[model samples]
Target: MSGPKEPLTRESLEPVPIQVFDDHMVLRPPNRLKERSAKRARTDDGGDRTVISRAENALKLLSQEFDAWMTKELDRLEEARRTLASAPSDAAADRFYRSAHDLRGQAATFGFPIAGLIADGLCIVLERKSEISDPTPLIDFHVESIRAVVRQNVREPDDSIGLALVDRLAVMRERALPA
Candidate 1:
């Protein structure tokens, strides 16, 4: 009875149709107007789009230089730490100070603001050594900061990460340095 309770099928469950526009049936983005505009800006060779090519080359050079500088600075920091750990002499402290100073200069030159700040902190701490009562704390702090610099660079491709670490180092340096 009542059409056998009307079997519920997919066709019966379907909703009403919605209308959508289809003006230009062209495929692949219809490069009509913009393609002509692009053609006007080309050279005879039509290979390197001048402004874009220059910017790309500059970026490549910067990336290469940044990688090279980072490697050298990391090596310098390692050498400084090793020297400090090996002996109890002013010479080791001096080496650490020089390395920190050089690193700061180079980092600044490379636009790595954070690395520069960290280098400044390390330099200030190392410079205060004149027969330190306990050099271990200072040495440990430098080691940690150096490790942070290396880690930050590895984690983030941007040099600004160095700035964040340096900001932290600045706070630590202020609290740790003697009057």
Candidate 2:
């Protein structure tokens, strides 16, 4: 058994050119871990399927999961709406904020990217007006816009209708702003 080898002399070393990447540049490298834990993220049990096929399957599965998540978020949105309607209070605002916050974070992941964008705007409005005073119309409008996005099944962020909804929400915020 060898204990240790002698260190290589400076003369034995060779200079190699190095490439510098910009801070914003990301480089993906090949995974050297177990086959199951590869970048493609396959099951531990080896499959006859090729990497490409596995990637396609993953996309299909992701769509299914996205639909499920969307459904759950919609339900939460409904519950929040009902709470705000039945009793317009800080607690109601808090409940709605929680649901809106979740949508703001995950809407894009579930297919409705615009919903997340609009939800963020709505959250800001709610944050400022913590207490639902006389003007509940703004709150209703923001909530309706979000519900419309879900009901219409808007997935693309650039859709004309989605853009309009976002615009209206922004205008409502503008109206709320004191001169």
Candidate 3:
């Protein structure tokens, strides 16, 4: 409705005052990509070697404690299984599922990927039923397989025994649960 608006210029624009709240802090996260790119540009190689070395060393240190952590988790899972066996209630089933679920999520990180697979199969079976009336023998098989894998240090996915156990469980799960 009015005449052509004037273009925005540095001199014409007035600075608005910003009030800082004492309770809340405003933070701007640094652009990590830009920082990484800058570091790469500054260095002769593509990226920083020291940072990668530090990360690898930290992972190695964590790996040293992984076996103990895995054992503790397995113990918890076994306890849950025992509880499920004795009680055979929804609550006990839930606890058992939770234990299996936790192991499924962390088994690979704990250097027992085969155990993770067995846990996954167990989770699938448990997930199929809301209230497990009688815990299936398949459940026992899965749990025992997980324990065996961890105990035997069967970390690799390609281990013949581990693969066979996983395959057998998969077939059992399919037969027990169906689609």
Candidate 4:
């Protein structure tokens, strides 16, 4: 043979090694194409080993603040209910809706997902404020449902009563929707 043999195995079908071309051995660049282009694996810092409990305590304190705020809102809701029962006007509806809407928006943040659901139900029912002829009972029921949740300290999504309340609200919303 006039030249060095070319490897002919099926595995040898790949392009010639960049390190070896013809009779000349090529010097590889210190930084390789693959090494330069490859991404390094990532791992999370996983954060402070000692302060975790402290952080949890801080969260508990914050949650207590939210709980207090929610309690005050519920009290306001009771007043709004009385007001609506006395005079069901857009102005009164606006106050009631704001209370419900505020609770719906914030209750979940303080570990009261069911309260949020019931409040959301009230918000939905009271949406067409002027259209509702007699919304006091429905509003009172939703407000009381949320109050029951807080009273029982019910937070689990699958809690039996909570689920029933959520289902009822879903049905109410569905019924209210235009078919």
Candidate 5:
């Protein structure tokens, strides 16, 4: 094809002297050049470093405190349930439900999903029976179930069964309430 069209060559395509488009055009070095780390980076001062370390230490302490608080709440819920079993009164059931609700909130925050879910369901059951029934066996069952769940070290609450039970309890409570 006509000697390959002279290889489609360009006369000035090779490297040559740079030319300015205008008189005030300042040349800029390529931005892709590697930067010196010392020029771009800062050395951490002892004060700033210590502040960060102290913040981390504070967070660790707070986490430990929160864990302890959650454990105490769990123990309190267990005790309240036991007391309800012995007395079998509306006030006792109410106290047990309140304790269980607190335990559920704390356990959920602590990532104990199994305990949280069981406590949630138990709370609903207690609320429904708070005014009239002797809810000792139910309270004991809930306490044991929660203990077993805690022993198993569950990370997330299983909400399906708990939600179902909560719904049933809600309907029962609605029917029992004054018209």
Candidate 6:
């Protein structure tokens, strides 16, 4: 042992800089296909014409069925609204929410973008549990507006009446929910 032990102090300590060793290595696997096959797979337009044609045909078939599907969804929403109006229960509320949410998701796909917007507004109104008190009238209005959009085939988001209806619904929702 030394004659006297020196007390360790900050001045006596040596500072060492941290060295971060990054072992990360990115490995990009090479393409295994032969060049001729790869070139043949892509068309001059940069897309496979056969795939594009198949997709278009599928879209046409879905479009042909879209009207019926939209009508079915609207009917389901209406039924749920009626159930909620008649008997306000958690199950009914959940059903109504599910129906409205389905419409919100599918309306645009069914070529009724305006209806989707209306469904979205209805969902917003219904989401605030604290604000919900006898919201049957508001629900009715939303259902009717959606029906009108589908009935008139208001597919364009920019349609004057559709825009006006959406704006009016927004005002109504704010008035009803107050936030």
Task: For each candidate, give its TM-score against the true structure.
Answer: 0.52, 0.61, 0.70, 0.61, 0.49, 0.70
Model 4 has an lDDT value of 0.76
| Model 1: lDDT to the true structure | 0.64
Candidate 2 lDDT by residue in tens digits, 1-179: 97557564432254434455875545443333344344554587466567578997887788888878887886887788788888878887788889989999998878899889888987877677744454567867777777788889988889998998898788878778553
Question: What lDDT is reached at residue 162 by model 2?
Answer: 93
Compare candidates 1 and 5 on lDDT and give the better one: 5
Worst 10 residues of 5 by lDDT: 30-39
Q: Please write out the lDDT profile of model 5 over residues 134-168, one tens digit for every residue.
A: 55555566677677666656554455654454455
Q: Against the unseen true structure, what C-alpha lDDT does each candidate score? A: 0.64, 0.77, 0.83, 0.76, 0.65, 0.85
Q: Candidate 5 — which residues are off by over 4 angstroms?
A: 1-61, 130-134, 157-179
**Candidate order (lDDT):** 6, 3, 2, 4, 5, 1
Off by over 4 Å in 6: 1-53
User: What pairs collide in candidate 3?
Assistant: none
lDDT of each residue in 45-133, candidate 4, tens digit only = 35454359778888877885876787898898889888977887778878877888899998888788888888888887878534555
Count steric clashes of candidate 5.
2
RMSD of each: 21.9, 11.3, 13.3, 18.2, 22.6, 17.0
lDDT of 6 by residue, 13-96 (tens): 444444455875454433333532465543456567777998988998879999999999999999988888789899999999
Query: Model 2, residue 179: what's the lDDT?
Result: 38
Off by over 4 Å in 1: 1-63, 154-167
Candidate 6 — worst ten consecutive residues by lDDT sum?
27-36
Q: Local error of candidate 3 at 50, Å?
A: 5.0
Residue-wise lDDT of candidate 1 within 98-169, one digit each (tens)?
Answer: 878887787655545566666777677677654456656765776577656656553332556555666766
